[model samples]
Target: MARLVRAALRSNEYGFALETPRAIVVDEGYERYGVTAEIASVIADGAFYYLDAPVKRMGAMNVPVPFSPPLEDMTVPTATSVVEVAKALCGRL
Candidate 1:
């Protein structure tokens, strides 16, 4: 993911996409387990200047998975959600 960040920064892209099974919220006082937060920190520490826009993250909702298949499906991010996030990141929505 760092490599991808570097590449996107080197290029003229607006931003990059990050997909994870777990949600990563910033400044929620739970840094120990936030992969997105850790990655954001790395970018801020090492490649802040290269960012043309904020990093975009797409992952599961911040809730335990439901036992029911339908509810479980709703808790996780889908490809459509990711695309929507990417669109928003690019100012397309």
Candidate 2:
């Protein structure tokens, strides 16, 4: 996702006002247990690729992390939300 955003920033077609040093604020949706490391890797890549501003991460509370089937779906943001966050990041640029 961060890579997609970076690519967008590099191109003027994405409606980005700035190029780099952009901030990325994520929601609790991306904080899945199995994919936490992968998500962190994406964050790290963002930082390495001129993500100078703060890479804010807003995730759910660090309890059991919620795995109760149906309950889990509502506990985090959907894919649309994540894209919205990326769009917001682009807007900030």
Candidate 3:
């Protein structure tokens, strides 16, 4: 994932991928804790046309992380989530 981000930042013709386990709500926390939106903005402003596909972001559910183990597990992004998002980005979904 780090490799993908680094490549995206350096190349205008690559797609960006983000996978996180925290809820990225629409608030100050989004910017303070997550770089998904900021990365998108940079891509849009600097390399919109260079993109071959849309940005792919897979994050936790839009809620606070639960204290319980089971609930916490349900809140975060899973392997399936990553696979699905990747497929969608590749136009296979």
In candidate 3, what are the lDDT values of residues 10-67, reduced to their tens digit?
7744333222212211222223336566555555555556556654444556687678
TM-score of each: 0.57, 0.38, 0.58
Off by over 4 Å in 2: 1-49, 56-67
Question: Comparing 2 and 3 by TM-score, which wins?
Answer: 3
> Native-vs-model 1 lDDT?
0.53
lDDT digits (tens) for residues 1-93 of candidate 1: 567655654473324322221222233223344656656665554445655565555455677667999887776666777777766666699
Q: What's the CA error at residue 33 for candidate 1, in Å? A: 3.4
Cα lDDT for residue 27, candidate 2: 56
Pairs of residues at least 3 apart in sequence or in different chains that clash in candidate 1: none
Q: How many Å off is the CA of 4 in candidate 1?
A: 14
**lDDT values, one for every candidate:** 0.53, 0.53, 0.53
Candidate 3 overall lDDT versus native: 0.53
| Candidate 2 TM-score versus the reference | 0.38
